[model samples]
Target: MERVIVAGGGLAGVRTVEALRAQGYPGRLTLVGAEPHRPYDRPPLSKAVLRGELDDTTVDADWTALDCELLLGHRVTGLTDVLETTAGPLGFDGLVIATGASPIRLPGDGPQHVLRTIDDARALRADLRPGARVAVVGAGWIGAEVATAAAKAGCRVTVVEAADTPLAAAVGAEVGAKTAPWYAEAGVELRHGVKVASVERGGLELAGGGSIEADAVVTGIGVRPETSWLEGSDLTLDDGIAVDERLRTGRPGVFAVGDCAAWWSSTFRRRLRVEHWDTALNAPEVAAANLLGGERVYDPVPYFWSEQFGHMVQYAGHHPVADTMIWRGDPAAGGWAACWLTGDRLAAIVTVDRPRDLVQARRIIAAQKRIDRSALADPAIPVRDA
Candidate 1:
């Protein structure tokens, strides 16, 4: 490939460029990003940035040393043999898709905000003054995080979730309900099974009748792949650009990585679209290798972490909703984990305040090792030994 173009200027795009260089691809490379700022860390947007603990989370990468063209503030607008951007059309022998995902905004004219960018964090942080009434829609990871930061900032926060409990859709009702008490413990209101009809500035209209007054309303519902520009393109877009184990999008010299990819996972025996930092950080390596005529499959036991309500939550591996979950420690008491096992093989693990369990469980899942159920259940026992 004489000229390679990587779309998107997030962590995945930067890593993809780095991976290509590391694999000794001495050719012309161009990186296009929609944001004016260079690629930066995103996880901090919800935590450190939102808390006003940080202003910039820019990735520590020397764009100069990378010897590639950086087209900041240029968004990919169209695609084909010739890729079209806001700047203009450009030809490429190869392309890497790392556009990532965009937050799904609710229909509203409200003081609604979604934390996805640095600017978004800054905007939301300003409204979270002491004693400010804040209504956060959704009790998922982002919602929980925003509530935590708002409460810590002295804002009276209330979370509105349509589900019965927080994280119900993600980790299932049983495990998600285990975390319900955290909201109340943190002095935040948790309203479950309530749908928001509309978000209007200064108030939120409930599905039925009542309305909740608020100074600010934040939506943390979810995100969708940022592939609208690629519509009708050659790539197969199944929730995201469908790709095989090698990250190939069924198109010659074109590949996808990070959140915008639904890659085949041999380990899970299905396709997975993991929109997490670890996936964006690691998947590019395999994609870069495969791009450079190397035969490699990018299949990893999915992992993600969230810092909410003074708890360090880490999860590893993928298991079906029906998998038997064995509790390693008491959730009500703290420092607990929910381990899922199929037969004797470890399927997945959700850990809270138990770093060692998460650490060991990650390795065990990576190795696809069988576990001793009894030992695994004992919190006193190390996950590795278990």
Candidate 2:
């Protein structure tokens, strides 16, 4: 049996192991992790875990119950042909890198927090008291969700973002401008188009002359690929481990997946790295297929979801050349769906509070079918049929 060594027991790594077993690959498997907890679901860490809806139930499958040798609370310092760990060196026929990502931390003292792991969420949740001032550094998804949770707990929340509008870079200003009113409705003070220069004893100084009083400041700017450990390992690391269409890392028996992998995407016709929960859940099956001698390529339609205030937002497909935008319903009225098109083909769809539209939008994007703009704009028409 070919021995398989999987690094970073995250969603991708766990799924790869399960996938390998399901494919009937009777190999020696070892899962390594820096975190002490068993490989758990991370999407909940930002949503339900922050809301205190779940605990360790976040894990997909129990390691002990599965009888897999798990190396938790230990960080893999170096990855040669073998791994140098605290226990001892281990060899393998194949390796999978799924270290995931780390939260962008603010430069400051102990008070500045970030919500990436369960511990980070626990610390932030304990401090959510009524009337306490919170300054969220970035207005991305994490900042938005944290602000919503803080506001619901009766805390005075102020979101400080460098961009003119939240998610301006991701969804573009057209859709971003339309989505701005939700923060105001949630009673969150949005301080857009300003940068936080420094952190003082109890507040954050802006690039401009003003400063905001903050009992707690959270830095949710963004996350980068956790590939620093592979610096001297001769692996191609460009933002992430550079992989081919087959998820191979150029080395003989190494693979990369999830947020830490920048693979050539045939759909986008470029190297792409998606940091969404759906990618983490979906990419490992492809990696597993290739590991078991099956020729498989991961050409998935990138998908993601976010919950803020009372809105459930979902996005499907890649919008590389999305130059035109069309709305299926009124944005002001709330429950609406919008599509970004490139040359008549659906590039991406952003659905707000419309679950059925999102499901239909996915089918439309996958089929590569062109729908009449007028027909798509009319909410009365079935999106799939259109």
Report the alpha-carbon TM-score of model 1 versus the true structure: 0.98
Clash pairs, candidate 1, are 110-201
- Cα lDDT tens digits for candidate 1, 1-386: 79999999999999999999989999999999999998999999889998899999999998788998999999999887799999899999889999999999888787699988988999999999999999999999999999999999999999999999999978889889999999999999999999999998787999978999999999999999999999988889889999999999888889999999999999888899999999999999999899889889998989999999999999998868326889998987879999998778898999999988988998988888878999999999899734
lDDT of 2 by residue, 295-372 (tens): 799888788898988799898987756878888889887688878888777878888998888888788887788867
Alpha carbon deviation, residue 1, candidate 1 (Å): 1.7
TM-scores for candidates 1 onward, in order: 0.98, 0.96
Global lDDT of each model? 0.92, 0.83
Q: Which stretches in model 1 have alpha-carbon errors above 4 Å?
A: none
TM-score between model 2 and native: 0.96
CA displacement after TM-score superposition, residue 371 of candidate 2 (Å) = 2.6
